[model samples]
Target: MALGGGTFTTMNKILPGTYINFVSAPRASAALSDRGIAAMPAEFDWGPEGAVFAVESGEFEKRSLELFGYPYTHEKLKGLRDLFRNIRKGYFYRLNTGGEPAKNDFATALHPGTRGNSLRIVIEAAEASTEETPVYDVSTWMDDTRIDLQTVKTAAQLHDNAFVRFQAEATLAATAGANLTGGTDGAAGDAAYQTFLDQIEPYTFHALGCLSDKPAVKALFTAFTKRMRDESGVKFQTVLHRYGQADYEGVISVENGLTGAADDTSAVWWTTGAQAGCAVNKSLTNRVYDGEFEIDTRYTQAQLEEGIQSGGFLLHRVGDETRVLTDINTFVSATEERSSDFGSNQTIRVLDQIGNDIAALFNTKYNGQVPNDAAGRVSLWNDIVRHHQQLQTLRAIQTFEPENVTVEAGDTKKSVVVTDRVTPVNAMEQLYMVCVVA
Candidate 1:
């Protein structure tokens, strides 16, 4: 008889391999889970249509040109370049509600946009020593350079390339070049943004950047942010332009746009990327705005203060350079009893780190394997304490007391309850000095 090896939930899980709870946490509770991912849906002239894609740090330039037909530093990609400058990575989805791809007899463009028109295919006969068999050299070219080349006896032997696919059943013939044509960029509409929201639902990201200034678009992003954080336990922040009344801690409303720019909403790109990219232990308060874009500093001191009070991410003139005033999110409605502690992004980062690390630890190491009893609870508590201790060591948090942590039996035998407190550290943004004179 074969030794039975499969997952089981019953008390008698004989022939043990591994029994697992495939069910993910319903929501991120105070007990477990952490957060630090960001997502954005934006309209672009080129890129994969109707899909979410990931771009890692330092890969922005290469990936942008491959997907969007523009280099990171190109004028067409200023917003994207700004974003990558701050954030280490990003999850991007292009909005192409009505775009169309360029096509030819041989193949079609990978994405539907005007940039696809730049693609060209070149075919030539391969050199052969003997006249017994003939070979063809196929090349996929974009702009001036060949991106892909294949040597095959027939078209049937050709494999699909990253830029385009080969036409099945078409007779192969030598051609100097065949440039793709008829690609068009569609108008970015509200439905396009909505489609982006739907497509990016299953993803985890640290922040969502809104490029649109339309009130409706901003409202859609805000509602999505609130719903994801409160209902789904998928915690993240959203950054937008001039959305001062967002009022929630999860939303960051930038108050100013870059001056001397064709696109007024350009600054939001860098700010959103920076907010998402900021390390768990760091704060953006007074962080230097080193982006290529120039801030529109038309507001006076009084106006700037009022803007902060109303939950606006403002850039201030510090001598000759511009600096972020305070890294506070939109939490102007905070009261004394429920202060704007959540307003500080640093506090959120620490809490999010703790929640994420603990959840991962439990899911990977302890879930279902350890018995759900007092000893098991103690083990879990110890692990949690150690996690907090690491954060404390990193100076991400302070004043962690072991006694403050408590894990106990829940209302049900299978459930557990945990309570803990932490003091998140914030970067020093202000200094008060008193000078004594003799």
Candidate 2:
């Protein structure tokens, strides 16, 4: 619908992580109507899937048909739908194995075309203006940041079952081999240990970042640092920080790796020396590593909240019954009243009110209210839980990783591993980052 006035413009847009707003004062026009239908609209709702506008118009009605007495319809922003659709699908961190352009990998692999990698918006005035309704416009653009395969691989390693086992076995083997005397002969255990390390080479993390924002970056840094501290098994001080400016700046790094012998080369040699870095490390916490992700930073606080709210992306293990976390923030926030029969009952009631479609899926509800039975023996309830988790992951990535980098060149050397600040659960869109001892 059109808002009537002498001649004016105002608009606002909300991108994934940022918001932009604009307005124009009423202008003076030579032509004036005695009954000038001046209107200012505040907001408009178009259902759940439709775009809602909270506008302040000079002359408009919330449900006005036409100020000029002609039929009118609001202009549908095709780009908005396109952008939101991509956001809903979320971004992926695919291992660019083909050696093509990484940007192309990101652009093409994550749903080719239609503003998937980056976003651009424009706000411009249409025609003449005066003192009263001065022409006005507003525009904004938001994009997702990108990291390298190493980052994704490393982060994934934290959750990788096989990789964790391999690292554990390798650490023990290396330790045992170190105690063995003489070069006369190496036992099978030594060989096996070395093999384990070799196998781990391809799965190592080499880069790190928020995958989009500083907060995400901080969360990952905190999580990994804590994990390393708990598992490093070494006794040494630790430190991490950033340096530099402009495009050339990156994270600083310095950490020691454990060695089997004194004369042997240092096992922990990583990017060190203040080189305008993002994070740092000192001493080798533990050459041996385990699988544990942490979230202890204000930056990651929202992320952790989002991650938890997103429903954990996947139901790792589901039995006949599962404790589905309806609201992770509330669940975690609670001290003694997190999960209540009353609360659970209320939630199920709301779901039931919505329809039997949902109620049919859940049986044996947690509070003895909602059903907990898996329909038709297919575990439909569990499936729905898993779906919500995936949805949560997608939403988290979209909300937190709006500042993703788009690596256009996918060549091997050009594909320098970087850290993904955010981790989308999607296999392809998941950000891969490396931790270069930084």
User: Could you tell me every candidate's TM-score relative to the true structure?
Assistant: 0.85, 0.13
Looking at model 2, report the run of 10 residues with the lowest lDDT sum.
33-42
Question: Candidate 1: TM-score?
Answer: 0.85
RMSD of 2: 33.2
Predicted model with the maximum TM-score: 1
Each candidate: how many clashes? 9, 70
Q: Compute the lDDT of residue 433 as modeled in candidate 1.
A: 100
Tens digits of per-residue lDDT, candidate 2, 223-320, equal 44334323542111111222111101112111111233222111111111101111111111111121111111222335433444322211111232
RMSD to the true structure for each prediction, in A, is 5.8, 33.2
> 117-136, model 1: which lDDT tens digit per residue?
98988888888513577788
Candidate 1 global lDDT? 0.80
